[model samples]
Target: MMKEIEFTLNGTRTRTETQPGERLLDLLRERLGLTGTKEGCGIGSCGACTVILDGKAVNACLVPAQAVDGRELVTIEGIMQNESLHPIQDALIRHHAIQCGFCTPGLVMSAKALLDENPDPSRGEIQRAIAGNLCRCTGYEQVIEAIQDAAKGGKTQC
Candidate 1:
């Protein structure tokens, strides 16, 4: 059976019908057409399906679609504003932090969540924030640098 779900998606109010056990990643990619959230590990060990759920970074693959009802969700597709990329995204590109791009979205979301809570996070904090996200390429040095650069601005609205 499909149940009605209402939530805020990408800053807009949204309503949809989803099966009780449907994963949030499936709902975003299949139903809503937000494909930036990837599915590297169905078991949630990989952070490719990360998204901001109620201001925290979470693996969408591990979250039930119905569980997001009445909550605020932000995906990689929603991080930009008025044709401009988020600072974290721009920093990633400038720092060459994205390699192959498979894990960029999740890493970006994780960094965004950290910056949102603590604009000035230490290197260790940044590492811990994205520990769940595994990236075979880039080795995380560039990713960590980008997050640090984004923090210098002290803005994490996106």
Candidate 2:
């Protein structure tokens, strides 16, 4: 059965009719047309479907659409403000953190979630924050460096 769900998506309040068993990833991409959130392993092992849900990073593919009825979600599309990229995005560009760009969105969301809660996280903490995410290209060094640079105001690390 399809039910109406209301939630904050990408900083905007949205309402959509979703089936009972539909994954949040489907809802975000198919229903809302937010393709920035990718689906790699669909079973939640690959963090390609990561998103920030109410201040926590979670695998969108693992969450039921019904579960997001009243929560706040931040996707890659929502990371920009006033036509400007988020600090995380800027850092990624500055440090060449992206190679294939398939996992960039998820990685960025996860890093943003981490920095949102703890602006000055240690290298270990940053790694832990993005442990769930899988990056086929860039080998994670650049991603880690980009995130660290963002947290330290572009100085490369804290």
Candidate 3:
């Protein structure tokens, strides 16, 4: 049976109908029309379906839509404010951390989760935070540098 779930998404109240076993990723991308969260490896290895759930970074593909009921969920599209870019997005640009950009949204969301909790995270902490995200381009050095630079108040990298 389909169930109706309500939650806060990108700072807005939203409700959707989901099957008993529908993943959050499917609801976000297919039903809710939030395509920024991509599905790279549906098994949750690639971190492409990463999203912030109750202030924690989680793999959307692994979370059932019903699990998010009454919770605060943040996606890549929700990170922006008043047309201004989120710090992580700015940092990625300033650092040139993106190449093909397929993993950009997930990477940015992961960084956001880290920065939101600890604005000035250590390098090791930052590394641990994003360890799940896999970037096929830019070698991750630039991505790490970008995140670090952001912690140090540097401007956008790309």
Candidate 4:
């Protein structure tokens, strides 16, 4: 059965039909052509498919397409505006946290979710927020630093 779902996607209202049990990942990548949400693991173990759902980071692969109806969803493609990168994205690049870029989107979404909820999160909090996201490169030190920089607007943190 095909069900119609309407939700806010990347700040735009989107209406589309979704098959029952269809993964949100497929809907974004295949149906909507939003490929920033990667699918590293089909299951929820990997956060490569992370997206901000109603201001919280969630695994798109684990979320049902119909479940997003009437909800707000933000993918990597949605975060930027006027062809400029979001602060988090810019920070990641400046910190050299993005190497292969496969996991960058997920990490960015996770960090955005955390910062949205708590603008001044501690270093440990940043770690916990991105714990689900696994990056084979960068060893997380730079990623953490990047998130911290974005959180503090590049100010010196005590």
Regions of candidate 4 where Cα sits further than 4 Å from its true position: 155-158
How well does model 4 score by local distance difference test? Answer: 0.92
Q: What is the TM-score of each candidate against the true structure?
A: 0.95, 0.95, 0.95, 0.95
- The residue ranges of model 1 lying beyond 4 angstroms of the native Cα positions read 154-158
Error of 2 at 49 (Å): 0.9
- The digit string of per-residue lDDT tens for model 2 on 1-158 reads 98999999988899999998899999989998999999999988879989989989999999999999999988888989689999999999988889899988899999999999999999999999999989887888988889999998775632
lDDT of 3 by residue, 12-58 (tens): 99988989778999999989899999999999899988999999999
What is the C-alpha local distance difference test score of each model?
0.93, 0.91, 0.90, 0.92
Pairs of colliding residues, candidate 3: 93-157, 93-158, 94-156, 94-157, 94-158, 95-157, 95-158
| Native-structure RMSD, model 2 | 1.8
**What is candidate 2's TM-score against the reference?**
0.95
**Model 2: residue 34 alpha-carbon error in angstroms:** 0.4
Q: Write model 4 residue lDDT over 1-158, tens digit each, in one string.
A: 99999999989999999998789999999999989899998898879999999888999999999999999999999888688989888888888888899999999999999999999999999999999999997779999999999998855332
